[model samples]
Target: MSLHIVGGLLIKRFGKTGIRSVNLLRFRLAQEFLLCFILTKNTFGKIINKTMSKKPSRFHVDESDLWCKNQCGFYGNTAWKGYCSVCYKSLTNRQQSSSHRVHQHASVEKAVSQRQATPELSYSKFADKRRQQSKTNPVKSLFKSTKKDKSEVDKTSSKGHHHLKSEFGAFLESLSRPIYEDISKRVQNFLSKFKLLPVNSTVETWSDAVQDFYQIITEHINVDPIYQTLEETAVENLQDQLEMYLMNRLYNVVFCPPNSNDEQEDLSLQKRIRSLHWVTIQQLEANVNDQDIGVRIALDKSIADIIELDTKTLPKDKLACIVESSRKIFDAFRLSNEKSEVDGGPQSVASADDFLPLFIFIILKANPPRLKSNINYITRFASPSRLNSGEGGYFFTNMCCVVDFIEKLNAESLNLSEEEFDSYMSGRTTAEGVNTVYVCDGLRLIHENNGMIRRLKERQEKYANSVLNLEHKLSEFREQFDEQINQLVLRAPLTLKPKRGKADIDLDHDIPHSLPSPILPQQISNSQI
Candidate 1:
């Protein structure tokens, strides 16, 4: 308080100009410190006196001088080359040189003469010494002080390189943060809903949940502001990365491979899971289109994963699981049609045509057997038009093309009798000689579609012919009306009246007269008039 009063008095006496004076500021600061020290001097006087009276330990002198300080003219102990920090590099090199000479020559004099004459040998020995120096332990070997320095250089270089790499990786991740966060939020929402279902849920239950989740995902992508804000190339790159991440998440969770177990309940659960997988595939297919290229690519990868995983686990671990894979193909077909009835997906019925055949082709490729059952399945359900066009035909033809290849690579032969072959190709007969296979759903559907196509063509031709006949009738009616009009004009009688300044000519006048008259006979002949 006293120091502040004194500083304020000094500042007030000089006014604002005193604040700008460095000498005044310094004098007042010194005065404040002098006053503070004077007030606290007696309080700390005893402690200061005691601290000043104490002293450090005294140093002792050695009676005999050490070799390092006396001989090497240094201040410390002589552990290496009579000096504390000195190294015996030349001494170690001499030892290595002597060892090499001992191995290469019988006498020291000849060895020295050879080494002197051959400069390459001395240079090689020096290079070897340098290399050994670089490798020697820094703490244990006195001759290798350079090794410590080189090791530190290497460590710093590696650290800097690793830092640059890590910084670059962090930069890339920062650029993709928006896309990553968006996909991560969506995946979390999906997994949250997925967890709501019980572990033993039925295929139908899981299918409904998955369908809803797929709809949400597509809607999120379509309406995302980030997609709208980015350029086309940037959008595609982000989409590629986002889809890879999303597919990875999905493959691990919803579409993960079923665990193998011999329990009956587990087997039943496996069947339900397989069914759910097919439904999920159909759902994915429904959402995939030209505008959804990311989704389409992701779907393809997911399908490949499912196929590879399933193929590795089925039918006694044999790679030939396609021999009896017709049932599952049929199930996918039925599921698609059933879904179509409910308007379950985003795809139209035409878009859904390839779903069954694609998986069928995958199965056949994985395990190539006789093409009989597969051919029947293809010809049965899919119409010729649908099977021959688009992706459907690609897989269909590939299956057929591989048939010859499979035959050439055959390890086992296919055996079938004439009766059996006929039965397999055509419909099977019952004990009553009735062909029960006629009622097969697949065949019936194909027949119905073929009949519909034929009917459509017939109706088109009939419409064209009717249009032609109608045009012909219109022309005939026009001609008949013209003829009737001409007959009316010919049947009517003709007459001529005299003009104001011209003579009248009436052939119907029986009495000839030199003067022309306006009046004439009541009846006039048509030809004369």
Candidate 2:
């Protein structure tokens, strides 16, 4: 029966007892209002306003209030009235107290009683308790530790990170220049490191691109394998541009950096390094089978030369041009691998385009004491192998994910306290070194949204470790070289043992040249489509 009907029936039963009946109706109405109010209000509330009534926190409410309000079966028995569903009928007898009052008027009296307290805790005592509690609670401790560490990384990455270095900042915004000029500097850098090649693909000036292509083809004939394989006059329409690009790459390592610590230099360097690896694997033509040690050495020298950017042999104005030339070679190698990918996934292809920055990749592959900051960078930012598929066909790959992770981690590092930050960076424990005994493990928590990427990264960790070993060896070699000679004397005493080779120039001898490979706009059109 409805409450109103029940009340009316009660009133009819107690017809002569008007005052008591009216009191009963008022009590019942008040109870109903309280119940509805309790249902609508949030189960938990901050102490927003001091209650005139002695209302208990909902925590003390019969546990049903703790159950989600949206669940329709909200109810409690006499012993657990106002409790959550789980605790309602299951409440122990101790939960019920006869002193509990239903009326707000009675609640006000209890509120006054609540103001009295028997105990007071000092600040130091509370702090110690909190510390103890945190130490014991793994979940809370982990959350706090993560937040603290993340904050520190964020603070540093936001402003003071290694990308602030100058050479890096300039590389990002490369200016466009004459194509022939760029090629000259590229050839110059290549010759300085690798033994001299007599002729690279020659460029020709023509009224139109086709004529230019014809002239380029005429120059590289009989020199490169590509030309030798083709019917001499039949492939005459092909051009020298492709040959020119291929020759430049085979000769040297080129590096073009960006103008942004803001763009993240350490990150860019790592990406470039990854690209360099892919280039090594994907770009070397099918025919030229060179030893890895020789190629790696050449790459190391090229990268060192590029980084030095010295202008004694080349004009100072040409320094930027030299770097730009290297960038082109970098781009050319990238493009060639791109071409290789389109050319029927040829088994003959050796060097592939790098997805990472070339110089950075070369440096890392050289395997020396990596720029500590760089290692720190890769550790934090570089995406593992999880970021790619065969779409670009391993062109860009997953290096950028590593870079992005570092950036995110940088943002996250801001929460670490000074001591925590110090420990993270140095892996040092204390004056006694007790805490430092364990290998400091850093975490890279990728966004959950990239679950596939996360799994991919897990697999790449091993390969990355291999690359790190290579880097360490390179670092050791550089250190040994540094110990042998000072910066000013690049060469060791020539008088000690070595003799220079004398070149015998023969006018009648057939000097080999690169074969012509054409870059017809039409070839790409059919392939790209």
Candidate 3:
């Protein structure tokens, strides 16, 4: 039966029961059931309508010609602006070419008009006029020379190309030790105050404090009499030095603050990367491989450099490590491409698309210690100008994007089936039947064995040389001994002496002589008698 009919019957029964509690409860339940049924019916209806209202396939033909409008005899579709894909592309190209031609014509006409409106002077005539002027006004020429020197000086100053060593020396001389000490002391005091705060404080608070201090120091450099003699560029450099000093002092407290989840995030990312150890170069479609020793070395060095970020205490040093690591990756690909060309393979330029996956792979493999904390620290505490632009900024941005990509990675990201990805993630299978963990372990073992073998060979060579030297020394000693024996035989003759008396004989050198003299008095008297 329909829910409406059941609901109506329940309500009618309730009315006939004279407002009994049980009847009222049954009526309420019937109302609730009817309301749910109505909602469910409307929802299903909308779904069916949506499914049925979908537009037909683009290739579905009505009364229109199934061929290209230009009569190219190729299949066409209205979705492609009523043209085949090729024709549409060609049409767009022709339009672009025509527009380019018109633009070039207009630019040429404008250039011709501009040329006609201005007076043209020949190079020789101009040179002659300059020579006559110089001859007529020697003082003017000297003034011009001075002006030219001044202009050159201005250019050099504007370009900020002053000799760094000289400028830095002058800056130090202008701002004496006392001034530098004061600035450092103030910075330390500011940092110490922040250090006294609870660990739960946000990184943004620290960043703002640092930035404000930076502005104050910059203003001081500009207005202080001690810094008045310094050049604008020197003042800027001093500001940079102040920033570095501040960050170095704050590195301990602000970076990976005690209350933040940075360490946990690092661990999670590291675990994720570990699980994805089976990812290979082929899957990433990167222009690198394990077979290329140079590429392998470059990748390994890059990983080492990135991992070294955790050890760096300064933001600038950390940035340098990141840049170095990125450069290694680029160099690896460029060298790989060159090698590929030499080997008769098609050459292609490596772009961000190729760089990203490889970099992501590097991050996954490196699994750098405190990866999240390092990235967050740099992003939050590093100089804003450094992160906003330039090569460092570009590469660091890429690093950030790669990290984010790794965090959000799924089967679709890797272009693998969901089931396959799940299997890999769950450790049920791996790429090419090789687990990444095992591969790393095996490589480490091989490296250790190679080092051991090399050491053993070196020791063997050293011992062999030692044995040869020992043998030569032994022979020399034998020769010297024989020569000495021969010389002794040639130079001296041996003789033996007979003993005159028993007491005189040296039968036992250890015994003393005149032993029985005192006790022999009576014996001597008896012998005499």
Candidate 4:
């Protein structure tokens, strides 16, 4: 107050310069006061501090008890800008149910802002009148009906690219060229048909699944199962689920003797199977069961962890409880080859029949978010190149589709708790929350994807652009043709060049050119005489 009074007095006593100085002092004083108030150990002060710190703050409030969690599942509550700070008076020391409050999370505000910015769909009078005419008009009634053909199955099985069997089907019959909006809508509708695809997914929702898919691939092959039970259905079922999710067809693969391995003849067959997204992973003996100490230790540790964390109360000493394994086979994937290239071919543990199953188990139990981080890290290191050289010498590209499947599953089930899962299984809720079944299917899809990628790469060399010297080739051909023509023209010109010392040789005055050879001896003899 004293400072303000002095400042006022100075301003009143001085000219414009003094007035400017006083105003500057006043602004500084106000700012200093605000800073002091914020750091004053008051809840309201801190809230004000945070609000003032960020841009576009209108009002401030105080909260003593606000906590935020950053689980990525829920759509409505992610913090877009930064932290979520709550201001509470805490009138009563007793706790209150946090869920009851209407306080806005940062994401909520961001969403609201976004929603507000978007324009509403226009409802024009002209468009409305045209729509109304379709209902009332009698002559065009037959054409106006949106009803689809009833006998689709009876119709040719070789229909359009896709069928419009469902009302919400993507392939709507139309004469006009497809626009971007229509394409987007059609994609959404088609994705809707995949029963395994998350029902709640929007058109762009599949994009979010990309990262998760990669994560699944990198780690699934590394996960080992401890139980010597040669193999069990637990992991198999999950791989099957993965296959179903991706709709891959190559979910089962077998590499037999020379003649039996003839399936690679038609490359596109593998692709078609993979498009459906089910594939059985193939392994070669060399990759999985390397006799190196490092390999054994890694596999052993992974299996130990799998058993310890997943199976409850199982004692190691109980020989019958945990049956052990046989032989030199390591039923898991590893970087078996020294290089991506091979003289005969790159060897793998395809013979280890149990490798695929063990790999699947490791994948499902993985912390998905962490797996995503690792897979992405690998991709970053593996920069794009002309030859698809192994960046980290990893074979999980096709395997990554598992991540995509898990993502969809996580998205669908994030709302459920353990109790909810129980209720769901019990049919108290109509939706069954069993995610394990679907995970196995995802594994199958990963294998199929791997096959497809190989096939696609083979075909891409033809269709995909390459730097070629077409212009030079054409130019060379032109030059050769032109040279030949010029030579012919030059000979003709010589025939036309005025016969310098000799009489003009025309067809009528045919000179006896054949006698010149015989005349050599006779003419020489005569000249000598």
Q: Which candidate is the best by lDDT?
A: 3
Best of the candidates, TM-score = 3
lDDT of 2 by residue, 1-529 (tens): 6566766777777785785866678688879878986986653232222233223321122233323233434321121232322333134223333334345657787677767754456887899989866655221121132456334423423232244323222331232233233334543453232222112211111011222332333554445444455564434222223332322222111111121132254445445443322222222111211222233234435445444432211112223322443444344344444554565432222222222334333333432222223222212121111111121102111222223323333212334466754564453632221111111112112222255577789779878998999999999999988877775465644457677887788657655667566566644566677
Q: What are the per-model C-alpha RMSD values against the true structure?
A: 38.1, 43.8, 36.0, 32.9
Residue ranges of candidate 3 with Cα displaced over 4 Å: 1-189, 192-200, 219-233, 433-441, 444-529
Model 2 residue 422 CA deviation in Å: 3.1
Span of ten consecutive residues with least summed lDDT in model 4? 248-257
- Candidate 3: residue 106 Cα off by (Å): 66
User: Candidates sorted by TM-score, descending order?
Assistant: 3, 1, 4, 2
In the range 260-279, model 1's lDDT, one tens digit per residue, is: 12134334433332322211
lDDT of 1 at 325: 38
- Which window of ten consecutive residues has the lowest lDDT sum in model 3? 136-145
**Ranking according to lDDT, highest score first:** 3, 1, 2, 4
**What range of 10 consecutive residues in model 1 has the weakest lDDT sum?**
429-438
Give one clash count per candidate, in the order shown.
0, 71, 0, 41
* TM, every model: 0.22, 0.16, 0.49, 0.18
All models: lDDT?
0.42, 0.35, 0.67, 0.35
- Tens digits of per-residue lDDT for model 4, 69-88: 23222111111111121111
TM-score of candidate 4 relative to the true fold: 0.18
